[model samples]
Target: MRQYRHFDNVLLVVFFSHPRYDVNLDYYERTYAEYFPNMVFVGPASREDAGFNHSYDVIVDSYGSAENLTNPEFYQMAGRMAHHMLFTVMKDHPCYHGYLWAPFDTLLNVPRLQQFDQNRFWYHSPFGEYVPNSALESDQDPDLHAPPARISPDPALNLTEDWKGWGPDWCDPHVGLPACLPAFRKAPSSQHRRLASFFENGTERFLGGSSDTLYVPGIHREAFLETLALFLETECFMEIALPTTVHLVVPPSERILFVDHWWIWQPPFNATFVRMKWEEGFEVDTFHTFHWGDAAEGESWRAHPENIEDVRELLQESARRQGVRLPVATSQVTGRSPTASSLLPVDQRQA
Candidate 1:
């Protein structure tokens, strides 16, 4: 087993949102602090206290003075903007080698973290092969290196030179279906015809960009900004934007590793522990970032109690496998006991 040590050049960004029953501050404090303590936590003002309370190394208050309508659509856009802001912030600080947008509610499988190589870009796999063929055509076009023209002609909306070529339709079918279908259905007759006409011709223009890549922070800052700009043009979910940008810039051979088996879902009311599979080498298993209608619901395995227990056992088992002995509880020499099961490794028999 490889020993995991914190990298000072890496910046771990945690996107924390409010009105979330699933946000586990304690877990983040214990897990992230132990591994990647130098972190920047970004979240909406509604839950600013949560981040501040955790004593995070850096707490960024998203939506500080911005005033906008509070609705589902606005919320979705806000979430996307939060990610964009994080990237922009990173642009100013060039000392970091990589950046990580870790989901707030996910539990860290430490042994798995030990195996992570920061040199590669990591991202989520596609939701399934539902994108139109045309969308994929440009993926191989060498000319696509140049960012697309500005998303809008409005001077006020004009993105910086590095921020051009952002537009939409870059997600897998399953992920985009729910978002696109509703807009397609609610449109007036003219808009409906436009959407219908596009799909009838082929959704390649709409569905071709990559939405999820497991790791991406290792690219040069300029390339990262360019990739981010391309995704912004799509005005799609950042999950889709991430991989879409990577596909645009990263060579096929050097593309980031993908998290295939990891499950990211909303923890149900009954979930008592984190749910994951230790058997699978998931790059990052995320859960409960935000509960957006049906979008939040995910795989059943994410909430099963058995699987949750398995996650715990896997952590301890992995520790033992790594030749790390759990500290004996109720130590006679120091009279100290372990405080956390997920983080602190301690012998259960002597407790």
Candidate 2:
């Protein structure tokens, strides 16, 4: 992915972790820090406070949100913190134009994403294939990236998980909490009202896209993140909370660029797929997520972790996707690097 273009100058590829789960943050930082110095690790303070031989540029608080949302752990409440999280990074390094919210296990199609306009908001969806004959079209064509007037995906299937949410009008914030109490005072700004108007006459629906590989431009991200946090205040599913906010909070919806790819739905393959192709060995068309699984046998297809910069080890949620030791990603013995490149991540080099 780095070969086609150097994302170090264009975007910040983030690998984030929640405190509840376990992943070897130090191993990853040490392993890829030399070549992919552009990347950064984000873990909860608890993980750092627990005293691991690690340091993170961006650290987020683990809200115990899965329990709070009464939803699955996969949601990660990433949508809730997107706003404040970026602020933490952008405050010091103003050079970055965008952020890609990806988990440690994710493998993005850097070249595929780079072909499009980085200035626009980016997301890929299975809800509806907006790009016709997407495989044949040149993703770089200026005409191909325009946003539709309104994208109404299959009505029977809503993008937002209506089944697993509390409300924009919930009676209590503690609905799923240990104590019963009122929460998130229905403080609807006119924009919130517009958001409410979206649901009042009809149910609020989601634009619907994978939580992974989401790209919010710096210009629009703050608003997008703020709205996403608002939705989290209601305990909306992160998947739904994300795209819904993308549709509502991001103005000039025309700027919302959805990249439709086969890799997104089940992606190029399931999380269990193996055989991490060599960095130069991969095809340019696919982002090719690393083959992930946790048995001692599962590690073999991991793009030859010993030789490549692949850090596809399964973390808590990803580890559970197949089978695992429970909380942490399957452990591997990766020696840390002694040299920190001049390319070291902004937060690392500057801070």
Candidate 3:
């Protein structure tokens, strides 16, 4: 007998900015709400923005408030940073299993989520575990870089001189030190000492000598949240900061799932184009569509007019078979094709 998890078993958190509000948000809201009833939306919203209708059951507008502690230096990555902080604030929710950081643009087909192992961490396969000198080679590939510059091979493990500007208290407003401090204190003292030691001394050893990104596979709630809280208090990219901190303490039992949703898209992506794909049936358990206000890269089949029509037909048929109308659009607003908007450009997509 196969068992699937219920909506209440997992809390889905979706984050986006005001700039991306109009772009297929209504579609995402309707589709996801029907798909996963227990979901929340978080973003930077002003008083003017608050009165508008949002699709999710709960909305956390973290703008123009002291709680909005997003780093300006990483403005391009603020949405992701906001996501990490959102987890911190909502970690204690009764969702017995765990939570997922769902990109606002992603259209997931999780027919088997009930079988998902809560302790298992989920990530894509593109970024493998950094194994010393061997893993760093990928950063040197010109095809991987848009401008062709060298990036730190292992941004997670290495702390180079370029990080001088990173000071403590970088994301304090968002993570809420006062709230997390009690949890931090509750964590074993040994964990605290080791994390402090690494932050102060271990960085010099793995200096990569250039600006590059880093990624972490997964993070455990109750266990590592305090250490994560400490790391959030410091100046570090969330992607790099998370796994780096986790590596220092978490054991092997807490696993990471390297998910490969799709292949890499060609470079020089005009910042808006992405490569989206759909076949026989939406079999992919999880998917991350790259950007909300974007289209497919010029040549990809996902963007091809014929393929888009085929996918629309498939979606209609699938909805019919399931005994439901296609997720009806509530609002009149429509934007780019959902298939293209879902495809994220390779380099610019979140790690």
Question: Can you give the TM-score per candidate against the true fold?
Answer: 0.51, 0.53, 0.49
- Write one digit per residue (lDDT tens) for candidate 2, span 1-351: 222223444445454444422233444444333324455445455552223444434355444322244554332343344333433444444445666555554554432344556566666532222322233335444344322223333233422453234333211222222111111223235454444444436443334334555677777756665565555555434444455555565553354555632233343343233223222222222232433322245231223334223333322222233232322223332333222322355455421
> Whose TM-score is higher: candidate 2's or candidate 3's?
2
Stretch of 10 with least lDDT, candidate 3? 204-213
Predicted model with the maximum TM-score: 2
Model 3 spans with C-alpha error above 4 angstroms = 1-8, 22-24, 47-51, 55-58, 61-77, 112-115, 125-219, 245-250, 261-351
Task: Supply every candidate's count of residue pairs whose N, Cα or C atoms clash at under 3 angstroms.
Answer: 19, 5, 8
lDDT, model 1 = 0.39
Candidate 3 or 2, higher lDDT:
2
**TM-score of structure candidate 2:** 0.53
User: How high is the lDDT of residue 16 in model 1?
Assistant: 51
RMSD of 3: 12.2
lDDT of 3 by residue, 141-231 (tens): 4233222111122223223333334432322333322223343344465654543443434331111111111122234565556556664
